[model samples]
Target chain A: MSETDARPGYFGRFGGQFVPEALSGAITQLEEAWRDAEADPTFGLELDRLRSQYGGRPTPLYLAERLSEEAGLEVHLKREDLAHTGSHKLNNVVGQALLTTRMGKPRVIAETGAGQHGVATATAAALFGLECVVYMGAEDCRRQRLNVVRMQLLGAEVVPVESGTRTLKDAINEAMRDWVTNVDSTHYLIGSAMGPHPFPLIVRELQKVISVESKAQFAAQAGGLPDAVIACVGGGSNAIGSFAEFIDEPDVQLVGVEAAGEGIGTGRTAATITEGREAVLHGARSIALVDEDGQVKHAHSISAGLDYPGVGPEHAMLADSGRGRYVAATDREAIQGFRRLSELEGIIPALEPSHAIGWLLAHGRDELDAGATVILTVSGRGDKDVDEVVKVMTELGIAGDLGNEVVDADPREDPESDA
Target chain B: MSAVTDAFTRARDEGRAALVIYLPAGFPDMETSRACLEAAADSGADVLEVGFPFSDPMMDGPIIQAASQQALDHGYGVADDLDMCRSLTGEVDVPALVMTYVTIPDTRGFARFADEAAGAGLAGAILPDLPAGESDPWVREARRTGLDTVFLASSVSTDDRIDRIAEVSTGFVYAVGLMGVTGVKDVASDDSRTLVERIRSRTSTPVAVGLGVKTRQQAAEVASFADGVIVGSAVVQAASDGEPAGAAHRVADLVRELRAGVGSR
Candidate 1:
């Protein structure tokens, strides 16, 4: 079903404002501001200018010939990895920062997992001259240490949340607590196409630049739409952005790859659509990894960005309505995809998008025609993941090998050779 | 009238605010929490709010959140909450209500939840996350089961929203004492008086001020305007201060002090 057919603030019985009473006024104000901003031409113009000049919009759509050959398809990459802050997170934050200014809020608060959104939010806050505070899981802080430093360097105070599970969901809980305590002067700059009503809608519209540009660019470059568009799903911001424009075109397939840490049935996966049931988390009712008592379960993933128990409510709707297909990639497969892209395409992708690449390599040939074109979104760069990847690779005994060959002997011929 | 309404009316006849105590079911442990609730009822609690612990409690403060986490860690579920409420209603003279996020009941099926709650002798329910705008299905089932539905109205809620909330609310209109979650604040905000007055003007449903009413002085001050005084975190903290028996003693003492404070008005 189209979004227009859904009730106000609802997407097929999924989305609603299930927040505390204290936040009712603020959410209503945000909805109003969003409506006004959507109607005003100046808002669109300003957002466009920021996207082009500040955020580096219209990111390239390049053909990865070697990777395409490997997949037995015409594989094109939507280069969101080249966007400012090294991800598509900049698009949503820049727009929300403008909305913060428009709503006359002087401060902004955000929650981060892998720190990509945190870095992007910190950058936008610095550019917009707003006071910024980001809540990140303490575990995530240790896992993605460089992004923490990046956020600090951009003048954002990072609060390490030491709560339940101490991951993305807890970070969100802390951020929501902070927002409830300080809603009058602060705007919650949510980084995903999730949360209550206006958040999912607003985030989707803000990040829609991905598919909007790709749709036009592909027509100009290849003269037709791609047969399938694929992207990794966490809270589903980039994937929804990559799928929003193509949702109506029945011929254009939409695919979202989730992180299956070990396997879907192993109880240590983040593949919400595959293994989770319908439940309420954060602020929306979506498919989530929940136990029999309706309590959300902890989700594990090698990619910190996809280490969440819930997905965006709209994605749940899409999945249920058969408008989009959801899949999973194991940590080992993602690592292989990470290495394969670096070797063949000279691009080191963040582990989040490596799930999409991994799925394509494993199932693209079986799922599509031989010459069908596919557009896969590389959502972020791997500069922040190099250390973690190296540690995991070393643990697996495949540190220096391009293939899975384990070299038992030390590469150094002599212990003191370097000295 | 429902048992909740009767309690408020009886408190009005006594010229005092109804004293409501909130504690999560199975907190610390099942036996200790039950003992604490019994002590509260024996000491002079007019109503009991039995909290059903949820995995993600967005509307709770640290003390209650920690208590809830402890309860969940101990493997408490909706069945445990129902059993506690059933026992409390059978043993105590005070009315009891189940407080939880809406998802618990929504997942369990609203009609089934309401029927089971009524069967357990619960007088009402307060779902903090289910606003009046989205409470139709739950309210319909609750009304079918003769259960009162309590909706919260904050100091920031608009007059029109307060009207809607008051119109739909059955037991009482929960007037949030501050623009924050459930916690003990140093002082109750003056905005609650205005909120209570607004609800009073719109509907005659008893208005209870919660979320920051911690001390006797604060309870007395709030009791001057609101028809009911609700306290949660401080009582939970008291229950956690000692062994089960000692904790019961502490809870009884605190409830007596709060009861006196509410009556002082």
Candidate 2:
């Protein structure tokens, strides 16, 4: 992610132009367009204007004082939850949607797991008055019915994908199908930094705005960059988003937390980067938690948003290069952490963000730098996850015990050590 | 019989349904999936469409997707899948075709993939995702290696698309019976019957109806519409069942039943 010593547009061998020959022409054009777009002051100005007016950029950076006290770490929250349509997902969509409009494409197709992105893309399509088709897994449609309705209400066609694994990956498969079939008039609005080459890099590039702002906010409020940056990893947008900025700040420690479901040993974890090695899982060569036979294994998470079998290839390379440490947290811990923030800080962290807090709790903060700031991007609000968290809490027999735990917990009690 | 084409002709004359079972290269693993394909072939399957797993297979239904996911899980991706296709020629002479979309071919270079497919002892290649209009460039490139480029036709294709597809397609015209994804419920309707007749009149290329034809009853019933009843989802459903070989036997029995139906009708 660091631009210095950058290997001619490569992101640590994870980012390159590995497009199909048919797309190489388009890829080359996009590369030039993007390079020009990045260089042009007007492009940034217009993008920022749209981000403010349409996406409601610079959502908020709130101090989770009470929650940080409970976690025993100073957990400051970057409120991507306040973004339009309730998640950091909007950040990437708004950029791509605007770019699609700029590229003169009138139709957009997107793939969705939890439908957060489907709804977001639908919202963008509706705003721009472009035809939108969102491919959602039959399984995901059942689980996230509200998002299905939300997308439909926004005038996007929801294509229920009854294909492979019946989940996020299948939705992507369907979307890619639609793209190849309709590429003449449509642009595929990828939702994550997990697909083929340029995609992982592009999504990260669009998402870098988060870390760019978070850094300035932290410096302005807390006097300087945080000692550590934390974010949950699915396809690793927010983590990669936040990590991109501080990747070269040698003094800063970068930590990515993954969902361990019941436990890391249960084989039901979404800890791809922590548990995986170099392999392709969803197109991009990344750290994928594949089985011994090299197939993408089923990833389990209490949160549907975090249940992906792989991390973005860039994150895999980053984790592999020891640029950051990837860790895991169990379902119970994330749930407890979710409740801890709600009770102590009066902020309900999205399940994906709660995974970061989960890791913070499981690994006592003794490992963190003493009095060193740990900033966790609260990527979204917990509104979508409230019912599920309630179920998990009741199943853990901790429905009413959250109050006591928040008071007893200490996120920074142990302090993150340099080691 | 000339392998795959011969299987279709023989089935046509015998008034029996030709079951073309499709298995992605790695459904859990290449060897296991190859065995499953063998089980299908050994159980009297007339032809086989061994899928070359691409990272994305948009036209597939859930069953195939699950199979592909299993293949991915078993470390059978595009490269492994091509190897599996190559190994098929050594295992059985049952004219196997590798079914993959066009984008992957475009990525690996169509000519290169075609050469590989032929070298792997593959009979031909079917790229369902390629449009009839766009087939000229890539298919022309694909044909350089002597691998027949099979194009698909839909029930909804106009006379023009049908003619275009028929013109370039060498092996067989994959006639999609319905206007939907794979593995959907196929209730034989007047539209399906008409679509089959419409395609039959438009091209001399042998037409095979795929999609939604699952049960033996459906296969037997649908066989009346086209030269071959391409049973994909059902074969997959059976192959993925707990008892793969036993399920294949059931499929063979279904093919026999359909064959009887075609003979009588």
Candidate 3:
């Protein structure tokens, strides 16, 4: 069993197999297949070969001279943006696709919000020559039309879902429905490190490479570990990946930044850990944005990827246990960080990771020790988000003043409120 | 006499399977929904499994989902559903069961939710999303309040899982007919019969076959082998296919047909 797959699969009372009984048999089969894949040595050898030969392994850890000078501290960037699919989503998809093949299932289905995971899962499906169908909300299909077309071009069918809220949560519901109907021949390639049982454990193990590589690279480049490792939290795939290896090192703080949308306390944000309650969502028990009536609310974020109302269960446990700090960055501050990285380092980062950069530039700057090093996981490139950022800036009439604003920490992330 | 066990025992004594009709509470409107529940009992429905509409119904298909959305649009919440159950149980001498998602109880506090549901005169609760393994809190509270907790078995479930679900289940074990959501199908599959047999071997708990048992003939087919047959989407469809005032009439007619279907078995 994986470290997190504790019998009924809970991360300290967070994750469990909370799906319908129609899906119980399928989920159990998936859990068994995952265990088998973990034991087989060839699975590792094949994945390694694919990573090095096809996925461009060991994406460089670059020292940001300009950004470091601006902050007066040495800042290093783990360049996951340079991976084959331009995001860290490929790490989980590639691993899951391998498991699908081992299970001998000829088809895969997935649900995506920002379309990054859709494109990545489609890419792996194409490589494996499997039939793939992706469910995206009608609104997200309209917003991320380009990525929708990209998925179609990659030989995957893109189905637009028009149920509940018409967003990521709806897309997931549709995908789960489809999986239930076609459980015999299909595998649901869940994008994030969330969902029932083996998915959270499976996704975290697949994504742990980010922190593992960053640890070794930091030891080689800076001759010591960075004082802090930061990543953005949507469903918390990249954040969990970036923090899993450093969880035991108490001195090296693990920071997970969430999208504040307008602001955390403003009642319109995706800051799940900061402003959410324990609820069952998408077959997992985690912190979720819900109304007083127990209806899952629509989370607003400029970044579609970070617009999810619920997060991975492990992130909930980590935050609850005080091992990981969960914070938020407003849209305006994220745009400022987006502009700073592009102008200072010539790297246009994805909006999801820009939340992490936003936190580092604003409140995180004062928290780090003087001259201490900080490592940030730039989870994806900004090709999918460039137009959205420009539109927001132009609409606000703050074209050139985007980088002039600084954000402060919302007190909801304070540990005192946690009790 | 209003408990689920009494209903099942009566049906067994009569040499017929129990006819359980699943309807969403406050569908269309509260008055008509209460009328429908009474009509169901009057039309020989042995048990009432009233669905509490959830915004995100993961286990429901198009028909039930649409009915749930309609109920939600009519301003139905946990309190309204419980009040509907109280009113229905007070008026009718049948076991009124509440079918809901785990989020309702999880959000409202599991023990408190179960206790309040019991206080509302509900004989039992059916949480489609909660498996036997993760049901400690709700099960404890439900047992404490004398409310039966029903668990589900599916075609994909192993013998061990069936045994696990049957042990904690008090009302009955729901045996899913197929590996799909709650919807209408042309016929009840043989998998459900085999699953019911599997559950029977594991425990002495009554087994109710549900999911895709839509038409009268399908209900009859399922009733031949199981202790109870549940028809959800079919009755909901009949109620929603006409004007709101006429929903109870349509439900009463469908309940008569389903009751006949069970009696024929």
Residue B71 lDDT (model 3)? 86
**Lowest lDDT 10-mer window, candidate 2 chain A?**
A16-25
Per-residue alpha-carbon lDDT of candidate 3 for residues A250-301, written as tens digits (9 for 90 to 100): 7898889999999878888989999999899989998999766577888988
For every candidate structure, what is the RMSD over all alpha carbons to the true structure, in angstroms? 2.5, 10.4, 8.1
* Residue runs of model 3 more than 4 Å from their true location after superposition: A1-8, A400-419, B184-187
lDDT of 2 at B66: 75
After TM-score superposition, the amount by which residue A222's alpha carbon in candidate 1 deviates from its true location, in angstroms, is 1.2
Evaluate residue A419 in candidate 2 and report its C-alpha lDDT on the 0 to 100 scale. Answer: 38
lDDT of 1 by residue, A189-240 (tens): 9999999888999999988999999999889988889999999999999999
Off by over 4 Å in 2: A1-10, A15-33, A401-419, B1-49, B52-265
Model 3 RMSD to the real structure?
Answer: 8.1
Residue B257 lDDT (model 3): 93
lDDT by candidate, in order shown: 0.91, 0.72, 0.88
Q: Model 3, B10: alpha-carbon shift in Å?
A: 1.4
Model 1 chain A worst lDDT run, 10 consecutive residues: A402-411
Q: What DockQ do the predictions score, one after another? A: 0.69, 0.11, 0.71
